[model samples]
Target: MSSSNKQAGSLNEKAGISSPEITNASAISQIKNKRRQQPSAEELISGIISGNRTTLSRAITLIESTNQDHTEKANQVIKGCLSEANKSIRIGITGVPGVGKSTFIEAFGKHLTSLGKKVAVLAVDPSSSLSHGSILGDKTRMEELVKDENAFIRPSASGETLGGVARKTRESIILCEAAGFDVIIIETVGVGQSETAVHSMVDFFLLLKISGAGDELQGIKRGIMEMADAIVINKADGDNIKKANLAKIEFNRALHLFPSKKSTWQPKVTTCSAITKDGISDIWETISQYFELTHETGYFDEKRKEQNQFWMIETINEHLKSDFFNNPKILSQLDETKKAVQNNEISPFAAAQILLDKYKKI
Candidate 1:
């Protein structure tokens, strides 16, 4: 051993202080054998722009993390990505349960990749308030697309966001676009008000349907259909083919009844078989035509701008509500006010005004 090391060890022993168990040689080896340091935010953005899949995945994970440290880092990564200025066709696909949404997405995503488009699928899964977790079953459902090198699939929980989409989905899309994906598909939890939320964000909204059911019309809200750019009927093979065609005709008639969208493009209805892969191209053609017409009319860009504005306002309102209710002073006051209203001491609005006044004071 070196003289200095021997002297240090001797002094430590004399003083009853234990020396570190690691020898200099072991320390050196440890340094040499250490895992590579993690890349910085800029490095991650660079890697993502270069189409590095692992880095892309890491960036997405960072974005999804709820921790404060992760949030700051995720913001940095997302900010760096925004400079790439990648614009993609954002599509929202929604259907009631059993409408083959997953199968259709798998097939549609593969089709986009085949056409030299980098496709990213963001799936919103139902959340359980009791567990605070989601099924996260999109990966399992889209096995084929999961293996495709050109496709990226991220399944996220709805997480108390009544909109049927994960809160960070818009941010996730920004990351994927920066990673160079040209086609982004958002699949909602189901066909409800969630459809309205998805419709607000996407360029083309497609509603998937199935045929030969007693309550086929009951499952799909007419308001949801009005928002759709196209309604696609899945499982259009085997004995279901004739029934699927009949349903398509019925939906076409139903769609004609609604006022035309601002885009001025008539929503098309078609049948597809995610299992058999029938009528896949037709759906693409319909989407392509919608984009072409909307872009030509300038409504496409206008809609996106409106959506951004809406989101900005929505986010601000959400934060205000969250902050007011979560304020330390407000929480206790709210608790008292709730009992007051329950006991007929105050009207509901009066109780709410009390909390708002308290929030303002705080």
Candidate 2:
């Protein structure tokens, strides 16, 4: 028997089902039978709603898979869970490397858990195959919160994608929500414009900053400040308290120079010391106030709906690109087209059109 057929037979036997006859016809029949036995959308939805973490993780893995065969199943699972999703608060936290973002999140998440809120943290680290980066360090930094039963911490690395926003983070958000998490915190490696991707996906964007450095604001860019719903000046205890306060005032003035974000809301600037755990309550209050104002004005729901639509469109575009490049015919011709352009026999634009057209025909 072929290895593939033997594997299939073993799977069927392990499941206490009768093995099919070992033949090509039986092999095709067994494959169809196995596919039919795969969990349906309803089963996945039920598992998620029941707070089965394993099922939740599997669903997210399916969505994150690059395999074209999984796309349809992933979509069905997401659609099934859509009605049960979106009830959780999505907050994005970002800052420069030394801004102590993970420390603040650990402190902040602990405080929320104290208030009886279930928190899930999705921290996206920079991809480093050979090194243990800060995010792995976060597991150690957030030891208290990580040990809490009510809190979940998932650290993902930024792949080829520009933003540290892991390709799986979006789907993971759904899983977290279905598992009854009240607050979903997304932490990104505060690398300037790339962090904007997180801003687009969340309800509130919080920028963390530290004081006492002459280049304090030098690391912060105007574009990032514009995207901030609020800024938390960290390290506000001890001798740095005064410096932190000064930085707050500086940020407040800078924020005022820009027009108000919405008619009912004004961007806020606050200071806190994560190590000392001071001013954390005030930070939470500010976030609550923003949420209330936006929810009352219907902006919160509108924003979430828009974000979902944007993700759907973005995902489709990514899949289209993958499919085009992975086509054997187009890939086979890619080198020839590049050589033609190099030799000036054809323009780069024309070569691109030819490749695209060939894929379209396929």
- Identify the candidate with maximal lDDT: 1
How far residue 240's Cα lies from its native spot in candidate 1, in Å, is: 0.2
lDDT tens digits, residues 156-179, model 2?
767656656787688889878887
Q: Which segments of model 1 are wrong by more than 4 Å?
A: 1-40, 68-70, 332-334, 338-345
Q: lDDT values of the candidates?
A: 0.85, 0.83
TM-scores of the candidates are 0.85, 0.83
Clashes of each: 0, 0
Displacement of the residue 13 alpha carbon in candidate 1, Å: 32
Model 1 lDDT tens row, 142-168: 999999989999888888887667877
The candidate that wins on TM-score is 1
